[model samples]
Target: MTENGVPILQLSGVSKSFGAVQALTKVDFEACAGEVMALVGDNGAGKSTLIKGIAGIYRFDEGEVLFDGQPVHIHSPRDAAQLGIEIVYQDLALADNLDVVANMFLGREVLQRPFRLDEAAMEESALKTLDSLSVTTVRSVRQAVAELSGGQRQAIAVAKAVMWNSRLVILDEPTAALGVAQTRQVLDLVRRLADKGLAVVIISHNLHDIFEVADRITVLRLGQRVNLYKTAETNQQEVVHAITAGKLEHVPGMASL
Candidate 1:
């Protein structure tokens, strides 16, 4: 939470459905500045639906979205971006043919007079951003993204998200497919993002990784928010139980489990 106790992003009574199949039902979620909020759930638990809604890929059927305590409607990806919201999906969305500097400034490149690409300025800004985030594994900003390791690629994706002065960053499965050292590198960077005062929402199924970097955990079960836990106060067992068998009495049309 911020000084006034308002989360950087908040959703109240959010619901979504597809042809009578409820994906999210009156769910609420919030992410505070300078904190890592982990969204954990099993497959079909509505985690993706919630995040996509936040990113404006799917509009909520019902709910009010608040950003910095002010109401806002995000109708498209561009709308979300303009509101300082950035989403780095699991794919990383980087062009393998492009170099680090080119990927960082993709679609938002700087231009000099006569529409010339401001290569020097873009490179300088990219280097500064990466350095500020302590991403030193990248050998050269001029090297093609295809030549980087999994961890290095993930770092670049994250760096791209925050470099645009984004206030809320949502990462989907950031460490999904990586070795131990690479996972550690990505997790450390995730923590550093929160430490730098950005509202971070990380979606991952790995409890170990979530526990390592999250300040709070939001568990979704069967399209409903079943539990909220302070990472320090709850154990992995408890969280797993919540995900698999949390109370679902409030969710209509769901069978008792």
Candidate 2:
């Protein structure tokens, strides 16, 4: 990745809590450029909490976040976006009534002059981005998002994220609720994102999809990071064990495991 696998995004001893409930505890996580780092865990294992913290949805109660090896404070979603971090949640967030181009530039539309939209520039850029990602399933970029299949919608959401020079993209359950062929399409797009030297963190419960796309797997259990494994060096059984029974000493009712 980025010279000896130095992480573009790194978190050290990160912790977050809500009143009496600890969602994340001293969790160390990193994602390097040119690789897909899959964040996996059983339900309520802090996967969402950890990414939300990184995405600036929730501030970490403790620990430091470093980007490009320099400490930075992320206090809001806008801050995260400025830092080139984009997270596509499972909802995909595309407006069904809008066309692909309109959806891609929903908030940050290019302007031609005083109070005019740069329709040509926006369309050209959108087409270029979709083409660059090898997203060819769409019949036309001008077509309504509601007409596209699940996979095409996911692709548009991802394309919208990366169009703004995003350095790191976090996808939450991208392939979930898709058909077999659609799943394949999204997985291939995930790999292409990493191949373009962008650090990609994918959160998914499907170990099969994780193994197919991720270069490294980070497993969380009971709000604690239990293990990190290189995909080629480990198997699904080991990852499953880590998710279900990995040891955690600090979390309540989990120390015995």
Name the best candidate (by TM-score).
2
**Reference-based lDDT, each prediction:** 0.93, 0.93
Pairs in clash, predicted candidate 2: none
TM-score for candidate 2: 0.96
TM of each candidate vs. truth: 0.96, 0.96
Q: Which ten residues in a row have the lowest lDDT in candidate 1?
A: 248-257
Candidate 1 lDDT, tens digit per residue, 106-154?
9999998778999999999999999999999999999999999999999
